[model samples]
Target: MDQPAIPRPRGRPRRFNPEAAVATAQRLFHARGYDAVSVADITAALGINPPSFYAAFGSKAGLYKQVLERYAHTGVVPFRELLRSDRPVADALAELLEQAARLYAADPETTGCLVLEGTRCIDAEAREAARNFHLAKEEALRGFIAARHPEAAGRLTSFVSTTMAGLSAMARNGYGLERLLASAEVASCAIREVLSTSEEHPS
Candidate 1:
């Protein structure tokens, strides 16, 4: 009599890499947004089973949090480097906006800022996760502006953040790089004007 064969346990594949899974999930989430990409979709994309997905990432939101971190580290604009103290505030800030315009439209498949798009996701947990990154970036912008132009820091930071949000949304809507760059140029002009006015008024 033949012995009965035991079935293999259901779980992540032996070669499964959590970091690679996060990168794959980042692509799906970036292309489709958080609400649109389900756990099954992620698993399928990563060639894993539901059990494996759950074992690797506690939930969809948990995976999204990791994706967000990866995007922040690898995909996001290097604000710290761009907002250097050596450069004039207006010039550096203008360059930041211009760089954002370029970045937002860099990828046709993964258009727009990932963290910005995540902020509008339907899931509360995912939305909050994205908002945290957005808030942190805003704080960094405020800090950079406050260092040189304390009086206009809040207003300038708000203006830049709002403009970047608009750029991200436009990029998601299929706006090309040239159009975004034009819009960013207008924003740059506005920033320069604000800084000039602040210096003249000195209050």
Candidate 2:
């Protein structure tokens, strides 16, 4: 019998290398600011040429947006579930802060929240997207409370989400795990106190 034939080299790939490239883009953008990261830097990280990178990600801005979008959506759904959980909103927020701290501690390089980083160098359109994203997060949180505790929805959503926003930003600013936990603890305590106050004084 004749030996099995070897596959011939195809001029172009049948499948675009988006997965590896996109992951690489995300990593690079997190490592270097978007404006600071050159296309060559991305190509080197991905081990692809500029043409291939462009083919896979379109443009630098486009690639950054895709990466940022992925990072933003990572735990959002599960996080929403936590918001709707019966564990008490304050406890749920505490859990989220712990998770965020662990995530950053595990790999500070890949785990810096991209949406926060992306806002630094983007144009008006991208800034608008970020604003809309925060608005949606706030709204989802409000709906979560409204569905479960209609009477206290407005105040709880505003305060808890604000605390979370501050903690998230603090974590991104390179706070140590201990510092992060302490910050979360403070937020949790405040949440609990506010809840106790609200319960005591029903309006």
Best by TM-score: 1
lDDT of each: 0.90, 0.65
- Residues 1-203 of candidate 2 have per-residue lDDT tens digits of 99999998977873446766677777777666576788888878777888877777787777866776776755332466566545666577667666655665456665445555455555665555556666777787777656645667788777766655565566667777788678768877876776665543211
Q: For every model shown, what is its TM-score relative to the native structure?
A: 0.91, 0.75
Candidate 1 achieves a global lDDT of: 0.90
Badly placed stretches (over 4 Å) of model 2 are 1-11, 14-16, 72-77, 150-155, 199-203
| lDDT (Cα, 0-100) at 62 in candidate 2 | 74
In candidate 2, which residue pairs get closer than 3 Å at backbone N, Cα or C atoms, i.e. clash?
none
Give per-residue CA lDDT, model 1, range 38-141, as digits (tens): 88798889998887788778899999999999998899989989987777888988899899999999999999999999999899999999999999999998
